[model samples]
Every structure is written in structure tokens, then in C-alpha cells.
Target: MVLLLGIAAGLAYGLTAFAGAFLAVPLLVLFADVDYHRALPIALFALGICAAIAAGDAVRARQCDVQLSAWLMAGSLPTMLILGALAQRLSEPVLGTIFLIASLVFGPLLLLTLRAYANRMAPPPAALLDAPRRSFTDATTVVHRSTADKVGVLFAGVGCGALAALAAAPGALLGWRILERRLAGQPHLSVGTLALASAVLATLAAGWQFLFVADVPGYTAGLYVLGTTAGMGIARRAHKWLPQAPTHRALGCLVVIAALALWVVVVRGATAST
Candidate 1:
């Protein structure tokens, strides 16, 4: 099960560049009987590794936006460190409640993000020469980015950090929505940039958790990491050949299912305790 959890988490990250932690934590809590706080660090560590793998592929493909990723990290890092420390003080039930709420909120939003990404058309070639508009090359495409987009991305990072630290889920669904709007034409670049940002933030937070909050089992972590590596390897090979529209819907359906499972866990835990 530990290995399977890792594979599932990694597969999700590799395919969508999001939700690795979200899927891991709930599955851990519900199936492995892991406490919310204890599961957080383990899930986050997996998320960090998963994101790193995806980001590396993206960077190698020249699909990443380094500038945007930097800004996102700048905004997310401080908040993650601070809130992560505070989270240790929260009761298991409270933390579980927070995670449940976050899952419910972001699950549907993930669908929306996917829909927006699918529906938006690529930028016209003339966009490359539009005067007074600043254009930059992301791999092979010329996309225009604005100052407002930068600020918005920063805020999105801050939001992701807060959610990651408090709820054990990176707010990548929110970040994706922002990227969908801001980087309309370039889906790979948007995914890559956000994956890079999420990788750094998750790893930093996991490191902090390891040092100050939790003692993760070496065996468990190893199993999860190994599983994630295998799952991502498969995704890397198959993602291009996969149909985009139905794939997005299927992934969205999985998110909704995970959210529903989380709801069950929270309610059962609360009932049992009472």
C-alpha cells in the first residue's frame, strides 16, 4: 500500500503537475491510519520529489518559465516556513478538518482549471510582433506577459504556501487557474513553471517538517519515493499519446473522488472520537 500510494501520487503529479500531496495525504489518512500531521511531511516529501521529476523534464524541454517560478518561490517560501511551524500546534482533528475543507474547495476548481486550459486557443502568430506589448519566448512560442501577471503569480504562490502548510495540499489548483488566465497559449510552460515553484516550496516545507515537527520513517519514505519514480516514468512515456480532453475529465473525476473520500475520513474520525 505504501508503494502503491507513492505510485498514485507520482502518477497524478507527472500527468497534471498538481495534486500529488492532496492525493497522498487523504489516502494515507484513510487507508494507512496515519495521523494528519505525521502524514503531512511524508506526503509533502513525495510531492517535492514528484514535482522535481516533472520540472526537470519540463526544463530539459525548454518548457519552463524560470522568471515566473522564481517569483512564485519568493512569495511562497516565507509563508510555508512560518505556517508550517504553527501547524504543529494544531490538533489532529482540526488539521484533518482543514485538509477536508481544502480538498472540497479545490477539487471542483481543478476541473475548472482543466476546462479553461482545454478551451483556450493558442496565441496567433501576429502576437509575436504586436507593438507596445512585451513578448518573450517560452521554448518555441512567443507569449506576452505583463507586470500584473507577475504580481498575480506572486499572490498565487502565497496562497499555495498557506494551503500547503496548513492543509497538507499545495494550492496548485489555484495556481493553475491563474496560469490558465495569464499564460493562455502555452500549457506546457504554465505547467512547468508551476511545477518548478511547487517543487521548491514542497521540499523546503518537508525539510522544515523533518527537522522540527516530525520523524518520518525511512522505510515508508523509501517505498513512497520508489513508487513515485516508477509512476512518473510511466507518465513521461505515455502523456503525449494520451488524449487531452477525456484525460482531463478523468483526472478531474479522480479529484472529485478523492475529495469525497476525504470527506468520509473526516466525518468518520470525528464520529469515532465523539
Candidate 2:
């Protein structure tokens, strides 16, 4: 059961870091009956590992824009460390309320993810969503020409980190949205750099929670790390043959939904049963 849960969690995360962590925390806390307080840390850590691994390809592509990225990180790191700890101290109700607020603010992005997935299955006008973004990768380069743009990124990154430290549910769409306008002009940069940086920052931020903030069972973190890395490797290999391939895209979306449903049912049922 432990191994099975790890794979399921990792697989979901492998598909996309946010999707994985968004759903995984409830599974670990509510279903696995790990304390919710500790679960947040583990979830954050898990996301960090997965995002970093997947972003490796982007790092190799020279799209990271190190200077601007540094600014973003500088703004985010302290908040992640601080708010993440504060989050650990809150009661479940308080945490839920906070998450509710974030969900309201950033909930539309998940709709976008849902829409993209539904479209991949079959075009749906009712989807009310857009494409699954590469987060910060496709955006941000054009902003580099001006200091004001970099400062904007810094503030945005800080905000994302603060929210992410709280729950990470909003960071996906929020992070991507932060970059969308900036990315509109710089088509020359590969998605790799942005991908890798987001992956790394998230991983580090998440890892801090797992290692320092939570009480994850023995080897659970290792399992998350290994599973996500392997999943990323698989994705990279597959991408070589079918860049932006329809099948892979669809598969990613369906996998997320299926896994998320599993998590909800298992966790929610367990909660009600208890």
C-alpha cells in the first residue's frame, strides 16, 4: 500500500507538479491519515522535487534568464520559508479557510487546466479553460530589457512564493499568469530555461518543507524524488519522438484527472467514514 500510494502520488506529480501536489496533500493527510500540518510540508517538498526534475530540460535550453530568476527567487525564498512555517502552525480549519481564499483567487487556472484536458479528449466549448501553460517558461524574457519588468517579476515571484507556501494551489495559474504578458514578445527563447527554474525553485521550496517542516515516514521522500525523476525521464524520452504530440498531451491531462478523482474519492470517503 505504501509503494502503491507513492507511485500514485508521484505519477500525478510527474504529469505536472501543481496537479500532483494539489491532489496529493489531501491523499496523504486525509486518506493516509498523516497529520494535515505535516502533510502540507510533505506536499510542498514533493512538488519541489517533481518540478525541478521536469525542468531539467528547460535548464539545458538557456531560457532561464538567471539574473531575473535570481530576483524572483530572492523575493520568494524568504516568504516560502517563513509562510511555510506559519502554515504548519495553523489548525485545519484555518488552513482550509486560507486555501479557500486562494482557491477563489486562483481557481480559474485549474479551470484552464481542465479545459485543456477536456479539449484534448474532445473539443469542448463548455470547457471555459485555456491551454496547459509551461508556467514561467514561455513568458518573462521580453521583460528583461527593462529594470521595471524585472522588479515586476520579483514582486510576482514573492507573491507566488507566499501563496505557494500557504498551499501551492494558486501558484500554478498565478505563476503562469505572471509570465504570460512578458512572454508574449520573446518567442526565440526555448521553454527549457523557464521550465528548469520553476522546477528548481518549486522543488527547493517544497523540499524545505519535507525535510525541515514535516514528519514524513521513512523513505517516503525518497520515493517521491525517485518516482518524479523517473517520470520526467520518461517524458523527455517520449518528447524526442513526438514534440507537442497530441497523444502525450491528452494522456497527461487524463492521467491528472483520473489520479485526482482517485485521491478525492479515497480521501473523502475515508474522512466521511471516520
Best by lDDT: 1
How well is each residue in 157-259 modelled by candidate 2, as lDDT tens digits?
A: 7786877777653254445445544655432121223344455566666666665553466466456445545544454444334423243344345434544
- The collision pairs in model 2 are 44-206, 45-206, 48-202, 48-203, 51-199, 52-199, 58-192, 58-193, 64-193, 139-183
Among the numbered candidates, top TM-score falls to: 1
How many clashes (backbone atoms < 3 Å, residues ≥3 apart in a chain or on different chains) does model 1 have?
A: 0
Q: Model 1: which residue pairs collide?
A: none
TM-score of 1: 0.84
What does the lDDT read for residue 7 in candidate 1?
Answer: 82
* TM-score of every candidate: 0.84, 0.67
